[model samples]
Target: MLERQSTVGSAPIGSFVALGDSFTEGLGDEAPDGALLGWADRLADLLARRSPVPFRYANLAVRGRLIDEILEEQVPQVAELTPDLVSFCAGGNDILRLGSSVDRIAERFEEAVVELSSHAKTVLVFTGFDPRGTPVLRRLRGKIATYTAHIHAIADRHGCLVVDLWSMKALQHPRAWSDDRLHLSSEGHRQVALRAAGVLGLRPTRSAPATHALQGRVRQPQRLDDLRWAKEHFLPWLGQHLLGRASDEVLEPKRPQLLPL
Candidate 1:
């Protein structure tokens, strides 16, 4: 498929806007000030180092957002913000639900990419994480794959860069996940940032730590860990599901405005 003419080389990616749920918001990876410093932020750092111009970044992602919420709240802002680049990854939350339709979610996703493609100089989209790493989430792998296919088709149609998370083998390790088993660990995020940079046709500088995934394969896990994860993490998440509550329903965005890095 023909890639849209990217501003990656012709011009600097001075501005980036991130939209999605907790993953894009940098959950599981906390900073000293108690804010998320996820892959998007790390990608911004990588971009800033490469570009001659100053970079601005905004993350409008909250923890429990579905694709519809992202469409209503985030997609409309793309034109107004007019970012040089926009990273969008949503619908994972919807995929996790009991009776969710992947087709319906894909339609919403396509709508978002269409809007994003219209306004941003460069638009990047992500596939769902490979669930094999976390035993608890592994049951939904088939659904995730179906949704991931839709994501790829949407990216192809819109000429957006695609980050195929499901194909990242390093993520299949236990260490790559957080205690919650849902979000990526700090090490995992680092690896993902490197992958994102590679997709944008950029290389990591010597100063930046190399992705662990690049070196080799990681070790396997113990069966006992699964039981412990179920007790400590999965049960609470199940409770939240039963109660119809969101992780960050009332919490304002950590980074609402596009500020210089």
Candidate 2:
């Protein structure tokens, strides 16, 4: 059994298990406890706000995790947690380390999802940025369409939800990412959390009181058709307008024509 550390005891009985890598570990920003507040943490914070039941989250992610490694190490421990909502954000390291092959990576990913479905109510699979927008993070988004397609199919087969971060990312400008060209900033985290809430059918706001809160936030809600546009077009344009060229200076390509060009 994988021993639980950093257990949020104040959290409700309900549990969420995150199985993935550094992104899941929140590698960039620091948390109150001195850990990085990755997307999972932000999502957890957002979900806690809207959860009707008390929520306990177990972030079972380590740095530099690969697909095969995750299958061997993380899968077994999932059965023990028996989470209500399961999130899996992997494949970055695998793609980075093992070389990008659509078939090989998808095979391992499919197997992981198949195993994970049996142990949870809904498995939310998280992925990285969209390649179309971020030219620098080629490793992160290479063969992304093919990869996400397989993931979409796998989620469909198992009745799980694939949170398409890639698609979300395509809609976003390059500036949303941090200096490392990988992880999200605080605003980026909030944007992702809001989208996650939309996916789970919860409101984007903080934890609210029971009565005044809206019901059926997720259950039978309309799917957000243009989340990519919302992120890419709306957010960036807004960012440009509000923050001025500074936002463009931060997010937009700084040196489009450089070097030997």
Query: Which parts of model 2 are misplaced by more than 4 Å?
Result: 1-13, 139-142, 169-171, 205-261
Worst 10 residues of 1 by lDDT: 1-10
After TM-score superposition, what is the CA distance of residue 191 in candidate 1 from its true location, in Å? Answer: 1.0
User: Which ten contiguous residues of candidate 2 have the minimum total lDDT?
Assistant: 252-261
lDDT (Cα, tens digit) per residue for candidate 1, span 1-261: 112222375787889999998898888788888868989888877777666677788888877787898999888878898999999999998888888999999999998998898899999999988786567678898999999999999998889999899998767776667889888888778778878887887754453454454446655457897788888888888777535765555766678888888
Residue 111, candidate 2: Cα error in Å is 0.8
Error of 2 at 89 (Å): 1.4
Error of 2 at 106 (Å): 0.8
lDDT of 1 at 173: 71
In order, the Cα lDDT scores of the candidates are: 0.82, 0.60
Q: TM-scores of all models? A: 0.90, 0.68
